[model samples]
Target: MEKTLSVQGMSCGHCKMSVEGALKDLDGVSAAEVNLEAGSVDVTYDSEKVTVDAMIDAIEEQGYEVS
Candidate 1:
């Protein structure tokens, strides 16, 4: 499944990389795309392996806020 999350505190390419990297590191996530300009993240993940809350927490762990 795919999920789009609104995220804050991403100001540059590095921030985007960090957020994307964190999400992609999760077990169920197959892909993550972070758009710093859009302040959002698009993630493709397996629902059976992970939950939305977990995905949110993973992004938050990288020092960002997701809504």
Candidate 2:
């Protein structure tokens, strides 16, 4: 499944990569694209293994807020 999360506080490429890396590290995540300009994250993963709440937590762990 695919999920798009509205993330705040991403100001640079580093922040984008941080979010991407964190999400991709999760077991079922296949792809994570962070658009700094839009402050959004596009994620593709297995919903059965990873939940939206977990994804939010991963984004938060990277110092970003998901809405």
What stretches of model 2 exceed 4 Å from their correct place? none
TM-score of 1: 0.94
- Evaluate model 2: give its lDDT: 0.92
All candidates' lDDT scores?
0.92, 0.92
The residue pairs found clashing in candidate 1 are: none
The local distance difference test score of model 1 is: 0.92
Clashes of 1: 0
Per-residue lDDT of model 1, residues 1-67, tens digit only: 9999999999998999898998888899999998878999999999999898998998899999998
TM-score to true structure, per model: 0.94, 0.96
Give residue 52's lDDT in candidate 1 (0 to 100).
89
Worst 10 residues of 2 by lDDT: 58-67
Q: Which stretches of candidate 1 lie above 4 Å from their native place?
A: none
Judged by lDDT, which candidate is best? 2
The clash numbers for all candidates, in the given order, read 0, 0
